[model samples]
Target: MDRPTNPTLIILAFFAIYVIWGSTYLLNKIAVTELPAFMLAGLRFVVAGILILIIAKIMRLHILINWRQFFNTIIAGFLFLSFGNGVVVWALKFVDSGFAALEISAQPLLILLLMRVLQGKKIQLMSVVGVVLGFIGIYLLVSQKEIIRQEGSVLGMFLIFLAMLSWGYGSLFVSKADLPKNYLVNTGYQMLTGGGLMLLFSPIIGEKWTSPVSWSTEVQLSMLLLILFGSIVAFTAFNYLLQVVSPEKVATSTYVNPIIALILGWYFLDEQITLQSIIAAIVLLTGVYFINTRKKLVLFSRFSGKLSENK
Candidate 1:
């Protein structure tokens, strides 16, 4: 029999990824109220990266890697952070945090597609169903007259879609790429690389901090939270979970994240949650569940059949 999971560890990890990551959307939205998108993201990662590296060193853990591994980490960082996170941060200027979370919840569907297209992974029957349901959910979310009527909303949603795609690709790429054996070390390098790139482009893009020193307490707190909880704690928990649990299970956190994000967004940001969005959240999460759970479901069906035959 498989070893039972430590309930405490599971709870803590789940709390980290589900609640911490979910809150990031709203916190990011708040942070951008005064900070430029690239600058906010760049500083968040750089600080988080340095902090993590320092922690690893203090713990006497290995943090060294060769040049090739460093390069790979940098590429993965740019894909995952610069484009994935950076664009999403920029898009938040137009999209509501709740809506953005709902859209980003589509990451699993995109990841599966990228795997099939790039790595030639076989597409299962339930996978097809999941993809179709995901598309239907997207249509439901975006097809509303209000969203369609507003050009900025449409553009924001499109940008979010691109961000999701970039994130998915980066995730799959990192899974296959060579990096430091320690997940924390690899992640630290990635953050440093991606953050450096963001800082580099910030000036080129004319992203200015209009009132960096005068940022409100809320924005300042939001940025600090993103750096500490979102980047450091949640990400470390996620990476550690990948080593302990099946990635399918890890990915399931995406389903819970949107619900938390919606609640937070509504409560704190006073963001509206429409009926269509509610339906979309259900449909999309259902599709994601189908995609992530299909393997276990197949095994359960086979076990049930054997039990029936024995009876």
Candidate 2:
């Protein structure tokens, strides 16, 4: 018998993916202060993947995957981590982080379109409206000055768009592809493959690793936090959510993540939260609520029902 998804567990998973992943942006900023980009990400994935595999072994879970699944998982990993995240990291060298965020926030709409165009899936009207609202909300949240403050080439914007496309397509591929039954095993293999590829490419692009011995205490802690909480915990939840929820709903995390990051900055870094951010949070979360609950809301159906009763 298949196990049912617990609502509480689902909510907790969403929380992990949203809040933890959001905080990772800050963690990455801190880590990259001392560590090289690709090398840092590569080490994070390889270490986390190894640790997760060890835990799975201790639990006596099946770790075997067939050849097809292995290749597919590698492809998925490349698309999501190597291409998706690696490109974003590269683009940040030229593009403003805020502008890059705006581009990545397009994933939900991209996924929704891909689902319809590529897979012939029918989406609800409310879902479309929700996605639009979510996009607008994100625009509102990020400062207008940040969006127009271009210090880089158009190539940076193009790269971020490509990253979002890769990420969206990779997510859809995972949902349909043949992967290991156990989520833990699947996540571990994906990370190992993706991170290994990044490590392979790091030297070719001339990213040399300085010894960590002299690295600051904060940088060391940031890296550890990324490996443990960001990769292992948050990514596992993300993959699991991809399996259980609608891809668009999973993409809704893109909207919630910025909110969490903003709140984290306010509380920990003493950053100021503007009135616009507060309003954007309300609008963005409302859209996510609609995306998740459209079936129950049935606003159109209720309106039509009232019309029939009046007749």
Candidate 3:
């Protein structure tokens, strides 16, 4: 008899992206304390982009392109990487890791709305339900914040919300952009061009890279891990999964990241994760599962196929 097939690699890869990437919000917070925020993130992409470009060339990834594709890549990069991610890093200066997590958790909902507007896909019933439930959950979580006495936290919250929307807009472009054949190579250019643009804009934003700052050995190690694991490895794995999996499945990682961020915030920062937050996280995650898997459930029932959804 033939040996049984296993999904061990898929499972491990899923966990690696889910858990490792999820924990990165706290890591990013720590990283900014030691280094300039935008500059630090800028450096991360600069390095990761170069590595990806080198690897793609060595693998003969065939990234040659026409002018239209070139323009598309830069546009997508500026929107997705520069505006989306740059805003998040900038907001982190005033936002707590948990607060940031709650706000950025809105990306899935934002993406849902964007898809409706951009593609005119009819919003399924459960999707609307899921969106409502997820937002309620996040609203509850934010209410549990203990550090919001000042107006700055409110402003920070607004900024984080903007960051999520920016990122969601970027995702919309990524889905709709007509670009080269290889998505990974496109990601390389996206990171490089967007990150380079961010570097150029850092001074405009008054990001003083040469400003002296305190550093911890742990923070240094964390930055290294983020540049390698979070920026390079996780993103490549993410794009790989995107190629192999459904868009809805890939979207689960967005919801999952906040859970991990919440945990790290509680464990390391001693930021209180209230009973309401715990319940809210569960609600949001449940909503995400429903949003992503409901269509598959309906299809499986119709075809009499057992569910084989992997994300």
Candidate 4:
């Protein structure tokens, strides 16, 4: 039999993903203001990756892996970080941090559809409802003329959507991919490979590199927080949660992250939160709830049926 999980660890992990991951949007927004997007992300993850490896070494953890695992880590790094997150950071230039978070909140819907397309999994009834609500919420959120009319806003939204697709597919891939048994090692490798790729591509696109010493205090602080909390702590928590919990449960972070991002963005960055955006967030998050709850509802109904039969 499997040993029971430590409830405290579970709670702490969830808190990290919920709160820390949420704050990354604001952090990235702050950093990307003064830093080149790919370069900023590349540096953050590379540093975080190196730190994690050093920590693993200090702990005497096995850090070696087979070629297959190495290749898989590279793929995960590309899908989840290099293209998925790096592109999103690039998009943040034209979009509000909160707006980008809200848009990315529809990730579960994309995942569900990808499941159907890739795995031949059938979408349950509740999930179907969720998919519809998710689309409606997205339409409402993106259809606002003022928001999209901003220069580069439309392109940003489109790039964010593409990033979401990469992330959605990455989510499915990682669940089954043969990765390092040590979550820390896995995370470290992914970060290293992903960040390395970003660094490679940063200059190919004509992005001018600047020294970190020239960065403003706020941007410097933001980058530090992102590397420490967002990349190291929160992502480690994320990798741990994936092994312990259902993907749907892991996805519940979606519900809380956008709320935290919205609040932080409004408070710190003076980003506008319109009434329509509020409504869309409600609808969109509700859809995410439905998608996540489907499995639980089924399990509950089956248990109730068993009890009735026993009675």
Sort the predicted structures by TM-score, highest score first: 1, 4, 3, 2
Q: Write the per-residue lDDT of candidate 1 for residues 29-120, one digit (tens) a residue.
A: 99876789999898889889999999999989989889999999999999999889999998988878988999898888999999999999
Index of the highest-TM-score prediction: 1
lDDT of 2 at 199: 90
**Which 10-residue span in candidate 3 carries the lowest summed lDDT?**
302-311
Task: Kindly list the per-residue Cα lDDT of model 4 for residues 75-194, writing each as its tens digit.
Answer: 999999999999999999999999999999999899999999999999877788799999999999999887988899999999999999999999999999999999889989999999
TM-score of each: 0.90, 0.78, 0.84, 0.90
What lDDT tens digits, residue by residue, belong to model 2 across residues 1-311? 65568788789889998888888766765676577778888888888888998989999998988999999989988998888887776775564443345456556667777888889988787777778777777677554454345466366777877888899899899988999888899889888998899999999999988777778999888889999999888877888888777877787786778666666655665555557756766776666555555464467889879999999
lDDT of 2 at 38: 85
RMSD of each: 3.6, 4.4, 5.7, 3.7
Name the runs in model 4 displaced over 4 angstroms.
Answer: 1-12, 239-250, 295-311
The superposed Cα distance between candidate 4 and the true structure at residue 125, in angstroms, equals 0.5
Clashing pairs in 1: none
Order candidates by lDDT, high to low: 4, 1, 2, 3
- Output the number of the lDDT-best candidate: 4
